[model samples]
Target: MNNLTARMRHGVIGVLSVALFTLMSSTAATATDELFGGLTSPHEIDLLSHPEIKQDIQTWRTDAGTQVLFVHSPGLPMFDLVLKIDAGSVRDGDTPGLSALTVSMLNEGTKDYNTDEIAELFERHGAKFSTRYEADSVSVSLRSLSAAEHRIPLVELFAEVVGKPALGATQLQRLKGEMLNQLNDDNNWMPFFLKNELYAQLFRGHPYAQPSGGTPEGIAAVTREALHRFHSQTYTPQNMVISLIGDLALEEAKAIAETVSQALPEGPAQPPIASTPEAEPEVLHFERSNAQTDVMLAFPSVTLDDPDYVAMEIASILLGNHPNARLTNELRHKRGLTYGVVATFMPFKAGGSLQIKWDVEPRYNEASQALVSEMLETFLRNGPTQEELDLARQLFRSEALNSISVNALAVRKISAIGFNGRPLDYIQRQQEEAFALTPEAVRLAVNRNLDLKKSVFISVGPEVPQEPLPELLLITQADE
Candidate 1:
């Protein structure tokens, strides 16, 4: 009996030794593989490493004069269709909110489907349909699975909504009421009031000055007939640019393009927007009993098509693109005068504006303004250093690469290019320019674009120093 027990123990010990040896051998193999897995390959594979992946965009025009831009992304079984019309709020000639209201009313109901039914249809197919109205264009976007069963029906529904929206009186009244309510509510928001007022003062009589949301009086005056007229004039094939991306072949893309183009009436293209005139330098003040004051300094800048646009973009980035920007570094980090400060380049089809905005303690409003002016003046005078230029270029390139890595953002980029009448290779060109940009080029662009002396300064808050109000060209009370 003792001998049997000894044999069993020895057997168990032998089994465990074999098992431990196998585990150690497997771990060593794994480590070795991980250390030199790709040594045999010429290069590693990273889908996002190439910035030129989006360079190949196919372009064609339908028989009805609808321009089509298709980017074939077959890896994903999804698709995005965006139709942009050149009729934006700027086209609302006399009426301010007409274009916005008209675009919003598109999905309310069509001749065949009620609003609920329209919503149900899109939801049933797991699709999303939405609209966006900007200064230069209005867009209707539809994202759906690319299966024929799913895509065909969704596209048809989209065509019906855009091509034959029933501008019902009840719906129009409801939308107008909503707009009026929003406008009334916005009055208490000093930022909104100041922005609109500043635009009115800066652009003056230009259409760019007109509020896209429309004033209360303008929204009240918009008639159903006027909506119908605007729709008839703007929602035409000739004025449309259709952008498609995802698991679609060129043939399928062409068919989809026809589905949209053939539904619309072939009408004349929209008229070109006139150039914005030079803005007069002005200081506008709005008084509000708030803890912190909002200040905005705005100046006329270059349009999207301007030669110095890329340079200005680089310059803007260096100035105040983020928390680490020069403006924020000086105003918030160094001085502790304001919590934050930012600068933005608002580019439109006709022209653009460069604006710097900040919020500061009411007591430091004058000091903040002086510091801001000094910083801008210093930047314009000395320009960026070579190290700063290199950093900005790298930052922009990284952002560009990251932005296009997503499918939806890539489609939006393509749509913007088409809407702005930019070359299909515009992004590539910009990337090249950014990489090759120099400090001198950026300085020249800044000098040619931004004019600090002619900028508009707007302050909205309580205790706004009346003593050093930078050459007040206009002053408005908050209650007004």
Candidate 2:
């Protein structure tokens, strides 16, 4: 009995020893692998080896107009049309929201269809139509199911909206009243006001400074004659792009495209736009009685055409892009000063702006501005770390891959590529550039673009100091 008991105890001990040994061995192996490889880079990626983008590109020009169709798998029984026009806020003249107003009026009423009939037609076809005005382009889009024969009506409606808008007086008056009410709303934050005011300063005589949605005054000033003239000038087949996607045969799609193109007027005269010029840093300020403080600091940067723009984009991402970005980590996570922050490098036709903006608790308003300013100075003096650049590359690569999967996203990308007058492979080119970015390139971008001293600072909060708000940004004082 004693021998048996001793044997049992020894057997139990042996089992426990083996379990501990296995655990330790597994742990050590994992640690060694992580040491050799990376720990923070969650997924192993080879961005240098470009992924295959299998897109069917079609360029067909009928007697009516040119159509570019990028067809992939018809995953769903739905189709989307991105109707892009060359005219945007850049041609709105002194009327800040004329383009937006014109875009809105299209669906309000048309020649063959009244507003109700148009809405009903879209509803019956199981479709929705929308219009948006960007910096240099305006788009009218339609999304409908293929089973409903949506393409025919969708194209016709688009034609009516673009070619023959019935700018009803009632709709215009209602839209103006709504816009005026919004501008008069005292609860609207003042920093937003300052941002638009900065646009006005930067663009000056350029129409690009006008708000995409015109101000109440601008909307009120728009006459029926002006809408008709603008429509006739801007909405031509020559200056438009019809992007069709989902569940349509190549030939059928081409036929539909031709029909839509033929519906547009020929030889529409393009509106004259002032040449976009370099935007210099300007100091601007506006005060408002809000509990939360908002501050915007903007400086001059590159345009869309510059090769350095890619580097600038990487630098901006490193500055304050994601929720876990450097600025957010330091200011929001560590110091607990502000909850919101963003650093964006925005490029236009001629020049661009690198803007860093933050909203903070009223007490930390001054500290937040000072911290951001100091960080900008430090980043400019010394570029991003190797770790930051790698992270930015990974982030950019991930975003590029994700965007390729969506039809709408692809259309938007193609639109930007079209704006650049580049090949459809611009996204891939951008990805390659991002991945190939060197530390020196990052440093150069920082040095050349970031001007902490020359930023236009606009602080809006209840506790703002009583000071003179300049009409134009004082870049010299900012630089000093």
Candidate 3:
């Protein structure tokens, strides 16, 4: 840490945090009142004529063993494709920013094309191509015309960027300087302060505890060789999932999948991440130079493989966001302690977390915390009411319907599900399971999955925590 103050960033880096980050860019829908503005209700949509929440996913594998999930839509001549690699920040190991920097450097130049040429190629074909870093994976997504003139050239260019990145010392140093500059400028943009603190304390010793993006020391220490090593080991064909959606035939889709998946060298599969364990109950506070305190209550939730996963999803809906939801009603609607409260589940491969977050004035911070904790306890002890259950079901049904009907949303849905290793019917089953949930089942899930005793409470605001700052954090903040 240098003598200059360390100013934490907020939004941009929020998506890159370690485990339970990304939030899937949120396919989850908001409550009815918020979505429809109360002009119409979610339940008003008739279930009898409602679109089925199903996908005709044509699944296959490339010779290199990359899993492909494809859905054909003949309405438009354009297509959306997504590719996932196991090289998220978790693979950074000792070099925290190694994985993120590696992916960011992908298009700075490739073996056959430079950054300017690559941008020109995409612009020429009217293609939208991007890559994002997640806790468990890195996603490279594209949307372009299906015609060979546009698609063929664009797809090949995509392959070049993914498989043949020109990652060397020059690109490494340039990107490092850019990242450090942003960290220096965005002093007040501490969006993930509470989230970073929460994961640091909650996960403690696990790799999941690592901060996404990277600390100053971590970023400066990242060598060009380390980036190449991380990319090669984790970006292999044996460890990727490809999802394609558009007006193309099965064979055409298969061809596209092949070009992207086989672009990388094969072998050296990613090792499975160890599942997150339950953390003991704890209270933590971050002193932010702000008037209102941002609060987050976190608990270890279900894994993708857990039977209670579906139930946990519904329980989240009932607890927060919805107009009549428990936490919102208690904290904001009835008492007016805050403007909005949100509860979210950040799921990893094996296990994940459920976070209830909100903000309140400094004077009311302690009271808001107690009220939220009490409301959570009562909701767990006594499950959602019949009306609340129906509301959450209707909301889920509406979201599910919209997800499959729209091409843009469906590609993301398919990519997320396939990356997590769920069955083709995972979304469909979740909807069906949510509709059939009895209050008892939801209660069981809330109790079985969330432990009030084990939950960690954290806040960021003007007041410093009673405890002294950790020595590592107290040092002079420098851009190592």
Candidate 4:
């Protein structure tokens, strides 16, 4: 062997000898007689020791509809109950933000308690009651300690919040005034613009793309009667899931759930979601006078059930997984092109977006676009190398080690199960499936999904140079 090769081999051997000696000496030091046996480091072989999530989740039905029950531990003096109504933004029709306002106003007044009385009830117990809505769900929560004799009263208060929220006209006008004034700021306006433009580009004509927050114009039209109709029709037990945790027995929990369900009217089934276009590529551009350029690039990539979804995730990791990731290296670190860049594969109920977004100096717009294009093109043709794939797997393994908390893992597991409509075993299954993704599988995913020719680019920046700006078809948000 040549001198250099021999020297390299000797260096490796020396390092291994040192590591072995350290391990032996550490083991010897740890071995000692004690009142109790000394322990070795906990077994790394079992990286996942998830809490025993006994999904003895029980269900009961009242004259109203079904109620779901699960045991909870609040570690406090009172019992907390949550009822998640499936009345979401989709039910608001074209009226944006109505669902959010409707939920928030639930605790503002009931037949027995005005807004002040309701707020004071919680303060008396050092607890809280709240209601809010999202695009697909609305949640109501009550918190108190276990030893408190007021568990049943807490249940009744929650029922009142759901059943008889007085949508006072004066209150409606006040909330609308506050929301309208806040929408003109750059941060607030930017988030709305981003969500609306990106989803409209992907899901086009779908209600999912509609604003969940009632628009200023829509909120202006909201009347007390309209909110009443919305409340009576949407909040029902059949469309709801109840979860109670902390200091309640199964029988008591069931009784409380029954009382909450009895308070609501038996509403009609939610209407089917309005049809959305298949996630095809469409270019959307927007203009704003900002100090820094903002950009978002997206393509509809995968659903929760797609077989290649795991490979796509792994590919995303290699593309923008770290400071040394291929995109970061080419676009930011090597070329000093931008502040930072990200590539993410967001798997959702249906197909979702494989999104790459960044902010860069306006002067480098042409170079930034070129670098993104070339990186994607190269990924499509050749994919990641074996060494790159190995490093990515190591990085993902390390991340899993860090994030395996009981609560965090539980949320991840439950969300995956709910979103995919799959069994709870789905998360455990991901560990094996994600690691099994072959390099060729990643290559196929990239080639199939990452189409440079037909993809959307949303840029909110100063003027773009003419050469790069005209290369892609552009539709400004102002027109729509």
Candidate 5:
């Protein structure tokens, strides 16, 4: 059931207005920006119900101080609920893996249900729940039918899982053993190693350096007492946001939100992460006997709040992220060096990293490294071509529309945005804003922010000829 059929023709394709940075939109019969509140001009004659799709969102705060965001989706008799808590690795304090260990115990045993009993409850009701922790937040999600008989008991069990847990030393040891085994297994996986090492190197003393999953030493240090205390302090209503989307009336949605929020204990929101210091540029190499070399070039980045964020996102797509972007055209298509290459921009709250990562056969190590550097330099010097910018905008717009194409996606996306303090309509605005992003704007952003001298180069694989890598010319302000 694709619902955006009319919207696609009007709002989605209208992004072609960027036509080589000239506002020549020959495709749209009439612009659909008017559909959005104050976002566009509407013609009185051609009033359409759906120019672009956006979910109807209702928001409020519970007595427990949890932010509740509800989307009244009228379709399947089901609901997707997500609780985004502010207790992640950054809040680990002196104990690095405390958050991960804390969440691992949520369903191990509740006040009335043991691990097996909890699993059976979910299966019997055809409900699902999952817990995940990342650098800045922990998410507990549920998918269950909205029918009163199923939803009522499952919601009760969920409340118990989150609010009343029985922590035991034996359970602690078993979970620790499992985490340690995973760490041991992943030790030799070079890509994982590179990511951990890069963050460690880039933010050595900051909490950002801590891995979301605990290290072996940290996992071992986690005790039953520590888990209990951590849970009490961090998993509280004040620090949480609830996202509920599915078939339900406003009153029913509000009742569910209250139940979930009121079940949590009261506590204050945690403090912000400390200021992240800038990382100095360096060249690093790690030794391993592998068939190919994995290379990464990283430049420090500002947060999403930065004005140039959208432009940089476009630059990442133009550089190597897109299928037919410059790097793929040069390395994979023209030279057949490797099957893939990717450019990633991490938009951390404090600061971030713009990294281009690729693996190439050992024989082409130096050639590939020089080629990557050359391509980056050329992009910084001249910026993305008109076609590249237009294509990137087209792709971005498509992704934004597709974001809410289903219930689960909308629930997760809206929840994340609400938790991160963005407007519910941010996605829709981004889709419309993509059309206004010009190539010159992207060029200025890339030139100002993506300096090679500021990037740290890292390569991991068996040693090859240690040829000095080519030097990149610094793009001057005048270059833009």
Candidate 6:
């Protein structure tokens, strides 16, 4: 490695070691004082002084082709296991929500147990089982005591649920009904409507445009056979990534992985999703009866694996990642056009987007939008000051460390490594990159990635005169 790289790594290690030592000594002292004084309440540790846990991931492939990432967290008597499958909403094909429905039904029932029985079994063993579905992946998480009696049964049960979901006709009907109800309910929420519209406009014909839970009509049309077929195709050993973190030994973790992998059917990974098209710059207004106008300015952005992702991330922080961000400072603090404003980057497996969103009074919609546009133009042209860059770096570093502090979040990071096909040290590399970012790098990233002419502006609120907003390209009434 170069001298600079060596110095950076050494600096990080030195800082972390000193912080850890200080925290341990302080904590011990505080506990002793509390014991003598008879204080029952706990004191908060200084978060800034807390050390970041270095990730030590042990990866290997099971005989059945399932990949495993294991981390031994020795102190805690509890463990977390995450099974991530490539079967997310993007894999739903024409039947939007098929992937989600199939994943949701995993714990509902297996060949040996019904939904209630499954729930009872886990609860009886002091274990928790839950599933999460995202755009590109679906994951099931299990938290259980590390004792063999508790962990073994739960692992076996999880394997059964993943390998052989019943997907009964009645269960399918019930879930479909619930999903439809949710879709209907979301229609009345302005943010939900605006988000869906913005995604649809940005992604257009892409699968990302399809809602993960599907529309009411789509949900109503899902059948038991369809769910079963999707399950058979998507929930396979090769398409899954297993992550285990807890007090278990390496051998024990391997055995658990073997059991789960052997239970799954062998199949190839799902095909890659088609790329999303570049967004066309346009303004769309949806008329609702709401008193406040919800506005979203979005543009296409780099993916997580993109070389420029770190720079884009820093640029986003400078824009509005924090309370003191430019958007909040100008739009809320100075102009008082809105209560708050935020800018964020949403990166998917195949694509991503950057969005600035806020709400304003109906009368201030035009002025607020104009101001936002002007600020964005200026920001892109001049870039952020050194102060902004330093603040963004510090905040990003703190947040990154905090994210992995908890067991659950650390487990999720393992899953992200597998799901995104990123390296085990991805988080560490990201921290290094964020700290190394410069003003010129961020400016280049902003100019290269963000194109105002190719962006989309979407607003949902009460109808207003169009003459005041020359940027308006399309106006339509929101669905009732």
Worst 10 residues of 5 by lDDT: 27-36
Q: Write the per-residue lDDT of candidate 3 for residues 163-252, one digit (tens) a residue.
A: 888886787898998877755544345456677778877787776777667666789999877877777888888788899987788989
Against the hidden reference, what TM-scores do the models get? Answer: 0.85, 0.81, 0.85, 0.75, 0.85, 0.86
Off by over 4 Å in 4: 1-64, 67-82, 148-150, 186-192, 305-315, 347-351, 385-420, 445-454, 464-480
The whole-model lDDT of each prediction reads 0.79, 0.69, 0.76, 0.64, 0.76, 0.80
Q: List the residue pairs that clash in candidate 5.
A: none
Model 4 TM-score relative to the real fold: 0.75
lDDT of 4 by residue, 1-480 (tens): 434565689999889966864555443332211100231222333333322213323344555665454434322234556666667776777677778778878887887888899888767766677666666667777766555356767677778888878989877888777656544442245545776678667766665665556567777777788889888888876766666654567777777778888888777656545444566656555667776677777776766667776677778889886776788776665555566678788765434667777877776665666668777888888988877777676555455433322222222333334323455444445556656667787798777766666676777667866333223223222322
Alpha-carbon lDDT of model 3: 0.76
lDDT of 1 by residue, 224-256 (tens): 999999999999998979999888879999999
Off by over 4 Å in 2: 1-54, 65-67, 182-191, 268-281, 464-480
Which pairs clash inside model 3? 2-476, 2-477, 2-478, 10-189, 10-191
**Residue-level lDDT tens digits of model 6 in 369-466:** 78788888998888998889888877776666556554577789888898788998787688777767778888888989988887788998888653
The true-versus-predicted C-alpha distance at residue 186 of model 1, in Å, is: 4.0
Clashing residue pairs in all predictions, respectively, total 0, 6, 5, 15, 0, 0
Q: Which residue pairs in candidate 1 collide?
A: none
For lDDT, candidate 1 versus 4, the one ahead is 1
TM accuracy, model 5: 0.85
| Comparing 1 and 5 on lDDT, the stronger one | 1
Per-residue CA lDDT of candidate 2, range 42-74, in tens? Answer: 255565554533345555566765546545335
